[model samples]
Target: MSATERGESKIRIRPMEPMDIDRVLAIDSKITGVRRAATYTDLIIGDLGKIPDLSFVAEVDGEVQGFLLARRDYFGEPFSEEGMIHILGVEPDYWRQGIATRMVDALAETCQEKKLNAVRIMIDERDDQLQSLFERSGFRRGKLVDYTKKFKK
Candidate 1:
């Protein structure tokens, strides 16, 4: 079977709650090699917890193995009120088990119900693996530049 194909593992995709923040942080930290507790706490679990449809967590046998955080709002011209995926993380041990894709599928279902025709995500250009994952989940590159500037205290 292919990596994208489901195996004996049955992943349950459900709306993410604030309670799932700890597991989400652990999975993210393991994958990225950096703990981002503040970002997840301040932005995701704090804010998106109230609006749960666009955010989701994947579970296998009642344990969280992955998460996908997204929001549907004005993402500018040609795709107003569309969805924007902020983060997708899966435990290293669960990689290539179709967990991440299932979470994305869950979000897609919610977007369809909410009448959101588009879902967008911006990944770091250096992250080829992430780009491939999104592509397999039906994402394509967009014509936009990510200009950035750092501010110091």
Candidate 2:
């Protein structure tokens, strides 16, 4: 269903601005246990290869309630470009409100506009809610198992 089909509450979805970095950081920390607000800014600027308008925010009442980071990339050998859902978070208070689905739709539209081959996402094993959302967005688990390593400096 479209956002319009889901009723209207003045939800404004738009690209992220410098002013949104702080709230985006807070939301990221709350959802992911990552607290690198400074590094996030740098990574966004120096790495990520993200287009300015593809990273977005969902707002209501003039406050940011959600954010989405989408990017397009190529594997070393693959001669094709694919889209990635690098990060997405909706404020805890706004859970189960379809904010995520809306963000996914927006990201998909952006990817299509840019002629991406496909959009992919990686979700943590424990986040059932987000997993459900991904499924609702037509994403299925691929053949790969998710792995990560933690290091301390």
Candidate 3:
């Protein structure tokens, strides 16, 4: 059996709530290579809590399976509402069940409602499945580079 065959259903995607932070962070840590601080909850909640209009979660049997987080921003131009998807993840156990696709659809709906011109996602080069999902959801590749710098203690 392949990895895709192993990751079958048993998951669902829905709007995110303040209470889903912990489980979401666990999933985030597994998907991304970041050591999240204990205060990660407070930080994600603080940024997304008030703006419920821009975030979502994926759950299964009352547990958070994944999450998609977006923020309102523009490309350094006028006040245009461009949404950026900062993170998207589906637990390894539930990889190919369309959970992440659903989350992206939800975000796209929200962006449409807000009259945003475009929604952007920076996918990890290694995440082929996720890149395919984004492509199916009407996101095309952009001619830009995504850069990041981490601070050390």
Candidate 4:
């Protein structure tokens, strides 16, 4: 059945609530195979508390099928702001159903409403599927390079 025929005429997207933490962690853990409950708790409770509209979930038939967690970031000497999509995940069964795409569109709309310069995300170079998703959603490569360092005990 088509998405419309399957009663998904509209994918309900809404801000992530504190109650959504468990389901969010489940979905994230299912994808990454690691349950970082503390990390998600901070995002759902702390980050969402700060910028409620930036994080969202996709619901179908009243079940939470996917989620996108984003935040507002400021950088550069002049301090320009942008929306950053930190994490996105969908139920394994719902892959290729356009849930992620819709969530991204919702985020973009929110960014525009907030007058942010742009929306950005960092995808692993090897993850072609995710790269394609962002590309199809109108995201392009930027000049910024990501660097990380780990502290030794």
Candidate 5:
């Protein structure tokens, strides 16, 4: 069911602004434990500066509850536009209230408006809750491996 069908009221989704950095950082740090405030600052300012429509925040009762940052890029191999959901976080107290789902649906709507070929996101293999959430959102598993290599600084 859509967010509206689930009786979501007093919850508003709007384009993220630079003034939202503090609350966004707090939510991100609380959810992920990665407290690098500068990183989120750059992301919010830079990404929104480029494509304002790609970033959004979910607010309830005028308080920021969650946020999603996404970007669109064009790939050349098959020549297609794609949308990537880079980051997402919802407050612990608001969990299971379909806040993230609503944020994603909003992003998907923007992607559709931009004519993106697909929307993608990377989730940790052990995150069953996230996996289930995306699955319920009509996302299917794809055959791909996420590899990483760290270099000494």
Candidate 6:
């Protein structure tokens, strides 16, 4: 069912702006049950690509209902540059409204315009639901492996 079918207003996907930061924090905190305000603040500051607004938001009647934060990555000279999707959050009230899918599509459109052939998001091995969503959205297991190293501060 579409948003209108569910009685929600039409969702407009557009480039995110600095002004949307507060609402973005609210939606993300709602989804993850944690407040990472500082993280998002840093992520969006001067992070937009040359394309103006590489990240985007989903709005309904001028109110932000969801957001997707992304950036371009350079892997030195050996790997091709690609777009990296760092975060996606929709207000809990707007779940199942296809808002996330639309946000991803918006990013894909931006990627296409930039002539980028790849976009990537990291999902935990156990998060089957999120993995399924991206898979349905045309992502497959790529060659790159997700790894990390930890250090004491």
TM-score, each model? 0.79, 0.72, 0.71, 0.82, 0.78, 0.82
The better candidate by TM-score, 4 or 5, is 4
TM-score of 2: 0.72
CA lDDT, every prediction?
Answer: 0.78, 0.75, 0.74, 0.82, 0.79, 0.78
Tens digits of per-residue lDDT for model 4, 32-73? 766655665345446444534589999877878898988888
Q: Judging by lDDT, tell me the better candidate of 1 and 3.
A: 1
Q: Candidate 5 residues 39-149, lDDT tens each?
A: 653565575455344788999878999998877766557667888777888988788888899888888888888888888888988999999999988888877677789
Residue runs of model 1 more than 4 Å from their true location after superposition: 1-6, 34-42, 47-53, 77-79
Query: In model 5, what are the clashing residue pairs, if there are any?
Result: none
* Candidates arranged by lDDT, highest first: 4, 5, 6, 1, 2, 3
lDDT of 1 by residue, 1-153 (tens): 643344666679998877887788778777766665565534665644463348889988789988888887786566478787888888877887778888887887788789887788888899998888889878889987888898998
Candidate 6's C-alpha runs over 4 A off are: 1-8, 34-53
Model 6 per-residue lDDT tens digits across residues 1-153: 865566768789999877887787777667777666455434454455222247888997779998888888755367767888877888887787788999998898788889876788888879998998899889887766867898999
Measured over all alpha carbons after superposition, the RMSD of each candidate to the real structure, in angstroms, is 3.8, 5.0, 4.6, 3.1, 4.5, 3.5
- How well does model 4 score by local distance difference test? 0.82
User: Model 3: clashing residue pairs?
Assistant: none
What lDDT tens digits, residue by residue, belong to model 3 across residues 27-136? 86776657656444346557545533477897776678878777887775565568888766788877767878888888898888888888887778898877888999
- Per-residue lDDT, model 6, residue 103, is 93
Q: Which candidate would rank higher by lDDT, 4 or 6?
A: 4
Off by over 4 Å in 2: 1-8, 30-53, 145-153
Error of 1 at 13 (Å): 0.9
Residue 109, model 3, lDDT? 85
On a 0 to 1 TM-score scale, where does candidate 6 land against the true structure?
0.82
Global lDDT of model 6: 0.78
In terms of lDDT, model 2 sits at 0.75
